[model samples]
Target: MVNLINQLSMPLVEVALVLQKHITALMTTLQEHLDAAQQSANANVVKPWPLDVEAAESSTNFPVEKVMKVVDSQRMDILETLIRVTLIEIDASIIEGLLALRSWEHLVRTQLALAKGPGQLFSPLDIPEDW
Candidate 1:
């Protein structure tokens, strides 16, 4: 959004920071527009609004389906944009995302265990009827 991409200089760190800023802004915009889907994702990415939260999941509101539609529409644009970038930059971003996901998984597990007690602890992978 800031147009900080100095192509002449080609500073990887500066470019990456610009990209990260844009991504964060985009995510913030999406979350504002698709709050229900965002909330469901934050609660459980795998099962997504699998709990009693389905009461609000209607066609009128932001559904995961709608989110997918929005994303799918831009899929090609995303690919096209990424295609211009160096492979190392894309790989670095992806690896960073994966690392963040791993850390998030651990944090979620720890939070769940603390909330439910040791005996009631369950892995997020386990598809239990109740969370």
Candidate 2:
């Protein structure tokens, strides 16, 4: 029974040692990855938009001016088209609301006409004076 327990415990000890080694290696790898990520983050810090523009301008090899002009032109065209579409949608909504109002007015006028003859305007409701 003692030998059998020793055999089982020896394998368990070996497995524990192997697991510890793997854990240590994993920790070291994770630390190395963390350091690399930190270094990369420091190296690749993002500049502000104005600084980015300045950098682009300073890099004279690229045609930044022409690209900007084209982009601006396209942007203006898109804005104009969007504005026209929005105006058309707004006009359609206004027309729809006006049509609905006109329909409601017609219904109200018809009801009022049916309620009274041509020159009489008021409706009398008979109510009891008691609370």
Candidate 3:
């Protein structure tokens, strides 16, 4: 029986390995970006029900009331921005995962082609010969 590794095409295997490495690197970068964004969001997130709404409503001084409203509005804006950025980072990570999966599938196909033959690799409409 032939050694399986010997039957593998070296150049094709090397290319697949390079593609896997690049996909891994991309996934790492995406995860790092997501982690950083999540950390920022956690740091800035404020739990509801702590604001002094009753005090602000009952306050007679115009200046104090206006400052409180402005501060609250600004905080809301910052939270919204954080949420949007975090979501974008998460989406990027998902895309990276998909890319890695596709690369892995390609590697499987190539390996199968090397072990068997090109005709046995993939067919969308027909089942593989091994099955």
* lDDT score at residue 95, model 1, on the 0-100 scale: 33
Best by lDDT: 3
**Superior candidate under TM-score, 2 versus 3:** 3
> After best superposition, candidate 1 residue 99: deviation in angstroms?
20
User: Which ten contiguous residues of candidate 2 have the minimum total lDDT?
Assistant: 43-52
Candidate achieving higher TM-score, 1 or 3: 3
Better of 1 and 2 by TM-score: 1
lDDT of 1 by residue, 84-121 (tens): 35433656443343333333334334333343332222
Residue 126's lDDT within candidate 1 is 28
Give me the candidate number with maximum TM-score.
Answer: 3
Tell me the lDDT of candidate 1.
0.34
Clashes of 1: 0
Error of 2 at 128 (Å): 87
lDDT of 2 by residue, 1-131 (tens): 12322333322222222323333443455457667888422211111111211111122243445434433334334433443354356674433323432332333333333432322212221112341
**Residue-level error in angstroms, candidate 1, position 59:** 52
